[model samples]
Target: MRRALHAAPEILANFVAPYGVYEMLAAHWGDTDALIASAVPPLLWSFYELAKTRRVDAISVVVVSAILLTVGATFMGGSARLIQMRDAMVTGVVGVMFLATLGMKKPMIFYLARATVARGTADGAAEYELVWERPGVPQVFRVLTLVWGLGLVVQTSCMCWLAWIWPIGRFLLLSPFISFGIFGLLMFWSLGYIARRPAARAILAR
Candidate 1:
């Protein structure tokens, strides 16, 4: 038990390193103590709960920062910049997570969405979503995934780019507006794409 406990950090470090965030976050937080404090709880409560002991040990650091930004935005209402930066942070984190999922060639979202759609909740009241996977939809599904990934990259890039060019205060102040705009635009674009897709239409009809 002591050996396992002693090895926990290294085990976590090794597991998460392949996902490409271990060093970046370590650098950002720097101090191991601080990093552990800030980073571990979220992972423990969120990701770790879903895994076996030897599986992935750490949640994405990007996710932690994103949570900080979101909480800060809510609490720091006087500072619109915090809110904008918050938007950026949240979007950036989500963007990276989605990209990582893509990189892994994992279909976490596709499966979850299918499960939700097909069965709804276990209770009888849930609307039945069509669970059928037609051959025709894979092409569009792939395209949609690409589009979503690209959209996240674009939004994160926008936030980071603004962070660089604008004064720190300005970036913070304007981020909310920019973030909200991007979000609404993304939604519209997604809606249009889905609305035109035969699979989506077929799903709706079912």
Candidate 2:
């Protein structure tokens, strides 16, 4: 609950505020402009997070990269629909990155989990590093990474298909809900998966 409270500001900035911005501006500024304007909140939030942390981490890189991609796509001057499709493209790319890391010594989820667990403390970070060496820990992260990668890819595909066929207003109305739904399911599944694994449970108990 404390973590959830701490994350509320980011959630509002990235998802809620952007949608509100687009809705408020779309009528006056036009879709392309509104889309570009809506990117501001998340971009600002990403930079703020980076500044607050004063250290680069996997999650920070992903958030900043995704925001930059969105901004770049908007500036490319395509139709509003194309701008809307930018989120799908960014998500797909990140999903691919997750899958690509499967070949590495530690998968993408390992870094993400480590960052979350450490919470900016050196001792916590060191503890997680030591935990990584435990038997089954590596495999757990790999499996979690695979699940998240596949889930994100599927979500991106769905978003792209919707953006392609639906009208801009309708797409905008539904996309956020779709994103939240998919992500919520993925997170729920991850918690359940971790709960079932003794190694993962040990990490969580720490």
Model 1 bad stretches (over 4 Å):
1-65, 68-90, 103-108, 111-120, 123-132, 202-206
* CA lDDT for candidate 2: 0.82
For model 1, state the Cα shift of residue 206 in Å: 9.7
How does each model score on TM-score? 0.48, 0.85
List, residue by residue over 1-206, the lDDT tens digit for candidate 1. 99999867654443433223423453565423222333343345444434432322123343455556655544544333343445455666666556566554333334434443444334311342232355455444455556666677788788867855675434433454676677788768766876887665443332
Local distance difference test values of all predictions, in order = 0.50, 0.82
Query: Which residue pairs clash within candidate 2?
Result: none
Predicted candidate 2 versus true structure: per-residue lDDT over 146-205, tens digit per residue: 999999999999998998998766676678788889999999998998888876675564
TM-score (C-alpha) between model 2 and the true structure: 0.85
Identify the runs in model 2 with alpha carbons over 4 angstroms from their true place. Answer: 1-12
Worst 10 residues of 2 by lDDT: 197-206
Residue 68 lDDT in candidate 1:
63
